[model samples]
Target: MASDTTNGTRTIKITGKEAMLKNKSYFKTSTGDEAGCAPKKGVVTSKIKGKVYYTAWSMDVKFEGENVVRHMDLMTHNHASMPGNTPTWPYLDEMAVSKEEGPCKDDIKKEKEACKEFTPHKADGPSPCPPDGKPSTKDEADAYADKTAAKECLRARRCQLSPYAPTGKQPGCCPGQTGHHVVEAGSFYNVGRGGSNSTAIEGTANYNADKAPCICVEGCNQYHGTHGLMHTYQSTAALNSGATTQALPLEGGKQTSVVSLTYKQAKTFGVDAVGKSFPESKCEPACLEAQLDAYHNKQGIDDSTQCRSIATGYKGDEAEKAANAAVVARSSRLAAASASAPSGR
Candidate 1:
């Protein structure tokens, strides 16, 4: 089959019978397939009315076909090359270094800047307890009870209550197996083995010969009997004594006095801030000291770890470490002052 140049007319130059045979397979290829085969990338382009146009277009991803199929296809794969021929994070060092200083240098400088301030915070009282003969009359006893309550409350807030221990046991209440309770029971016989109880009647009242702070309207009602007027705090946060209707004497059990932590102290203690407050209650000296020591010694460090980690990631842990370091260094000065106080131990 041939095309005449003048009018683009197709012609067959052969005998009539041969021409007939040629016409039968005029558009056929060697593989017995049709001519004008489609391109592998699909759809061809054309210039119609002097404007470029496409017969069709595809948006699907380019897939790699077998070598045999690729050879048979008309289109070539230009996209199947290295992805940009370079790593994605090319400027990693620039990103990490941010400024003229490297990350390590910046960290050191940051640490120095953090330590610029040098003034120390004033210390706390020696102990939560008062003078030896402090709690005498009902008013004095109530005051003592209140102080004790505050300290214990602080302790409970700092330490997590152990699930294995009985429910009534306050946080940090487990001070080893010494069997020495924080607040002893009221009965001389130790009748009620666990939980809050007051001192028995036989226990001596330490009211001194000096002027009493307040008058006793009632006798020593340690167990919340009519002998004394009971002081009640109705907050659900408080522990419940067995007797519901009767107000119990200001007995010690459940926490009373709690440690009040500054942002600094909380850091040192490895405290988490999820349940945080502006000024949170915390543990007493003994328990806090133990915790601090555990943080310090557990890792075989010469001094306590500046901050103990409480599952708040690196930022929280680092801050706590700095705070703890400050507290331990300041403890000696505070202790000296405490020793000179009237009721200091």
Candidate 2:
């Protein structure tokens, strides 16, 4: 049994089964009156040995005409109230009481008028402030001029290699030529001469007046001849000597400026040349060796002797053919061994 002595005057006893059931109607008035029942106020409970026990109360209340029951926690002061039969029965008394006085009508009207006086006005037109101006420095002006000139050049399909001239050079103009030429070999022919036709070729090279072999021997063929002819000659030389594209420094502080190609480019050129010169797939080993040499040369590796030996041992397509033959021989041997082996009955 649990006893709720909330007001210290009225005591309501609730059994263990009733507490378990928690029937809210048990606390209502049994007389069937118009106002709903009011349960004992602030009924605090605890559970001991699986049975609910009433402990204490925080609020005091009397069962009146239309008041509903409310419980408030003694420690936390949290309030809870039961539902009422009338729509506003629980808040009727509070609603009937006078509320705190608000601002008067005249005061409200005066406040609105004051707010209206200070309100911001919308602008009649766009801002009177001017837009930001461009930079005025010489460098900025020059850059803008360059950009405009580049755009003009691009529109005209011209090359803007030098920024000094607004109207840039033509698409295929040589260094000193006004018009495009089919071949630019005039510069290379006057390499070592000191007359009006002379042009300096930069880089270290030994020159002899008698033979005049320095320019060609130093491998400046690209500068001396057309690109297609030079490329063909470079491809042939690389295939002949398993040397990569790297330039080798000779004695007397001079370097051999060799024309170099990437591995894929070298392989393509070699394969094409081999197919034209020899039977189909007959010089594949040489082509592969050339590609390997190009790769090693590009990486600056120093294994020239070993690479040359390997290429020589398996020249042409001998390496690939030998590997295929070995595979076929192994297959035949395996088939023969399997045939001669004893079979289980």
Candidate 3:
């Protein structure tokens, strides 16, 4: 006798012999060709009386003549909710049985070897290095020097400035030694003692200055090297002659919306004529507040819900204008209402 649980609630108790005889109708139909059962030879159905029961089958057993040997669990879809209450095809039960074993040791080793040899695709080509040769401006040279120093600092085993590194006093191996220090302006170390006191130079040396000539170190502070000095002189001459001032193109130029520009870009446009060409460079809320204050003596309306709604609802020039209009309309309405209303006193 065997007891089977269908759908985790109902328990079915029936003998193997009784189940076979009761569900004899399903036995003929349940095969590999008809119901997608694994083995074509075995009887998959287990029923008691007219109702279906669960039967276990195994792959180890094979059929021989009249003596039919069923192996593994012959799982079937339970139609307990159906009107007829007949069990569906024995496909679900077959999935319970495991097929292949886990991957062997050799297979894992081969995967590791393949992964080691694999080269990832690079969309931007080789790694980025700081700008080489001398930069035209002191700003550019300073920028290059900082970037190169940061890169070298990152490559070293220990970086004093890095938050991830161990805290407290620690010596670093990089040149321009003043213990381990982060590369930045105003960082100084003792050079020599003068008049019974120590003299300190407020700068560090550029480690890869030859390879990366734009790297401005302590020595290049006065002129940022010969190339930088030449560029500085040339830039000054150009500026004096109005050569540096580039007029915005009036026609046959690309038209882009100003709303796409960042807050800083918009602010730059407001302050500098160079950004005036971009029509879409409208200022955000803070700038809008300043504009409202200047035009209407209003400061609080820019950050209000109504103003924000109007701003977001419209785009580009329309957004700024609409927001301003809404603020004005609201203020007018409030003023008119206050004037008409009777005094409470």
Estimated TM-score per prediction?
Answer: 0.16, 0.15, 0.13
Error of 3 at 248 (Å): 61
CA shift at 179, candidate 1, in angstroms?
11
Off by over 4 Å in 2: 1-310, 318-323, 338-345
- Alpha-carbon error at 39 in model 2, in Å? 81
lDDT by residue for model 2 (1-345), tens: 023212322233234222211112122211111112223222221111121111111112323221123221101111222211101111111222342222122222232233222211111222211132222443332232222212211112111111111121111212211121111112111222323443322211222122111111001222211122223433343455555544434334444444333333433443343233212112233323322322232222222211110021122344334433533443454446457864211
- Answer with 1 or 3, whichever has the higher lDDT: 3
True-structure Cα RMSD, model 3: 33.9
Per residue, candidate 1 scores C-alpha lDDT tens digits across 163-226 of 1232221111112111111111111112232224423121112211111111111123322211
The reply for model 1, stretches above 4 Å from the true place, is 1-125, 132-134, 148-345
> For candidate 3, lDDT tens digit of each residue in 1-46?
1223222211222342322211121322222222233232112222
> Candidates 2 and 3: which is better by TM-score?
2
Runs in model 3 deviating more than 4 A are 1-128, 134-136, 142-345
Lowest lDDT 10-residue stretch of candidate 2: 211-220
- Candidate 2 TM-score to native: 0.15
For every model in order, what is the number of clashing pairs? 22, 0, 9
